[model samples]
Target chain A: MDHFILMDAGLGNFVVFVVGPIFVGFVIGALYLIIKSIVVIRRELKNEKASDNENNEQIK
Target chain B: MEILIYLIEGCIGAGMLFIAVKFTILIESPIIISGGVTENKKYIASINSITNVIFNVVLVFISFYKWPVSSILWYIIAEFLLIPFSEILAYRAISKASVKQIIKITYCANLLSFVAGSLFVFILIALLGLF
Candidate 1:
């Protein structure tokens, strides 16, 4: 199976396309995760500030 | 033979795309975006690589569908034509650069890479034929 696929240029390219980009896609995916986490953290902080403001208002 | 040639061209084309994008980012940084991709270059490069891979795969499927043997040259005309637009859109999504800036950078980059890659392939083919 490996012999047949490895010997052919066409099959070999598919391997390059797939295997080569795994690292690239993985890195990009990690960047996306970091961006997402930052956005989520910002939203959470904003919501906490909003809740804290409401509590202060209630106490006043 | 045709399929083999096509596959070889595809591999070379993809490699050229990366080199072109990287170089274009450096060259255009001063004139276009003024360090737009500087800090996020790693991210952007990875994204561009992924986008390029997706397009190449699509081209392969399209080219291989109708025939058992195919030429990458004719299909490449269509591929290069579409690549810049997709690349522009991809770059625009990740950066704060203006549309005009993105378009110019992507266009120059794709053109440079396509010309270089195709020339290399043709030369290689010619060299092979000589022996």
Candidate 2:
């Protein structure tokens, strides 16, 4: 079973093979989430403010 | 054959994260006025982290069908690193920075880290003569 996975894998191989991908995955994933969260927040705030103004005018 | 499999697994997992983030941003674009900007960013960041953990767990399951305990353990450890990264970016985004500037900075950061990780992996593979 070990031979099937890697002809000769050690701690180093496991580090690069298993941990490496997860590291890269998180890097991109976090960025995507960050930008996304920002965009969503800004857009939502803008819309909410706009609606609030409309409601105020309606109340008047 | 095994090397290619690992490479593909990494790519798929990364791609899945990208798409999941995009989908989340799109679906939650409208604000419900529950809190201030900073508060909202924190909520969104927390949500993203949750989804990311679940996503990574599923990816690990699919990638390693026979799930060696060591491999799964290492993967989980790596996934935890995302929490800090996400929080840092969230703080930056909610700071006084403009959207364009924040996006550019985060994009460069992500690209640089990805390239660095890939290069390190390749160097290790070359050194070990695994490929």
Candidate 3:
């Protein structure tokens, strides 16, 4: 268990009550960015594969 | 009226869980376990939200009727001990992250939620004061 009492109560409270939520929001935003990147990468792979098939058919 | 209040609190609890978990997973390795990370997050968050709401209500009732503990002691137990412990276990069961990673995520995420919840209640109290 965390001994929050022995620590600096004022500073801990300030961090948790003031800065904490903002940090959480930033992390959540980064998670969304990860999702966006994944979607983009998948789309790029699909497009590349489609183009590859087109070239192969044309060559035949 | 109490039912409406419970419904509102339940929504708030679920929303808080969703927001907290959405972020906490990024605190460590952004593990993409062959897709469906989002699905897992939703599943875990739903379980957590329900548990949290019920636990809080029980805590409140316990502090009043059953146990009758002091405010400070109750706060310490609920915030420092029980809630975080439960969250850690919940994350561990559902999350594929390492033990260290899950611990960090749960603690930090709970801190974030504590801050937000305090502000939320403060706002609600303030709004009530106006009326």
lDDT on C-alpha atoms for all candidate structures: 0.55, 0.54, 0.53
CAPRI quality level assigned to candidate 3 from its DockQ score: incorrect
lDDT of 3 by residue, B35-124 (tens): 222234443444344444444545544566545455446656766678677666655554556777666655665666667666866888
Error of 1 at A59 (Å): 30
Off by over 4 Å in 1: A1-60, B1-39, B65-81
- Model 3 ranges off by over 4 Å: A1-60, B1-39, B63-72
Which prediction has the highest DockQ against the true structure? 2
* Interface RMSD per candidate: 10.1, 5.8, 13.3
Task: Please give the distance, in angstroms, between residue B72's alpha carbon in candidate 3 and its true position after superposition.
Answer: 4.6
Candidate 2 chain B weakest lDDT stretch, 10 residues: B28-37
TM-score chain B for all models.
0.57, 0.37, 0.60
Q: lDDT by residue for model 3 over A1-60, one digit each (tens)?
A: 266664778788767654455445443444444455446545644655687689899999
Per-prediction DockQ comes to: 0.06, 0.15, 0.02
lDDT of 1 by residue, B13-130 (tens): 5455455445544443343334353234444444444444455445545565665245465446544666677666655645556788777766666666566656866888999999
Give residue B122's error in model 2 in angstroms.
Answer: 34
The sequence of per-residue lDDT tens digits that candidate 2 reaches over residues B8-121 is 767776676665555443333232112122335445544454544454555555566655675555545543455335534664644445555544444443444334544765
